[model samples]
Target: MNIDSMIDESRIDDMMENELIGFISTDMSDEEVLAFIDELEAEEDAREELFDHFAN
Candidate 1:
């Protein structure tokens, strides 16, 4: 499935409203923010891999 097809504005808005996502502290340092983004990307990659495996 295409990632773009799986997301829309409402989904983005809902994610923004989510407590865990909404509560990200502005106090985070640049390094901390980068690390957090890297972790999220890694998780997304893993999820995609699992989806692809299952799809086939």
Candidate 2:
């Protein structure tokens, strides 16, 4: 369930096998990945709100 471990194990090289493995690995319980994306989106939304507030 650890991505650092997964990242280490991931065969991310300049080849088709590496590319396939990267995408395929995502197929298994990508919760942490989704959560990271959600956090990024929330931070972006907050920044936009702050900017608009100050610009007004």
Candidate 3:
């Protein structure tokens, strides 16, 4: 919900949409890509929890 969180989420979305690591290849399967996405979501959740503690 904060601007930085929004930006971070947008960046993750863009990375998945890119379909290329650099300028060449995208050999990853949908499952791998989704797993990576889950990792990002977990990270975001951790950060939000930390922020919530700090806010309190």
Off by over 4 Å in 3: 1-25
Give each model's clash number. 0, 0, 0
lDDT by candidate, in order shown: 0.61, 0.52, 0.66
Local accuracy of candidate 2 as per-residue lDDT tens digits, 2-50: 6753443352222334433455455556786566556555655675577
Estimate candidate 3's alpha-carbon lDDT, on a 0 to 1 scale: 0.66
**If the candidates were sorted by their TM-score against the true structure, best first, what order would they fall in?**
1, 3, 2
- The residue-level lDDT of candidate 3 at 4 comes to 79
Off by over 4 Å in 2: 1-29
lDDT by residue (tens digit), candidate 1, 1-56: 46653764346445434633754578988887778767666665676677668767
TM-score of each: 0.61, 0.49, 0.56
Best by lDDT: 3
Clashing pairs in 2: none
Question: Alpha-carbon error at 25 in model 1, in Å?
Answer: 1.5
Residue lDDT tens for model 3, 1-56: 78977886687567645633442337777787777767766766786688668867
What local lDDT score does residue 1 receive in model 1, on the 0 to 100 scale?
43
Weakest lDDT window of 10 consecutive positions for candidate 3: 16-25
From the highest lDDT down, the ranking of the candidates is: 3, 1, 2
Query: How many backbone overlaps does candidate 3 show?
Result: 0
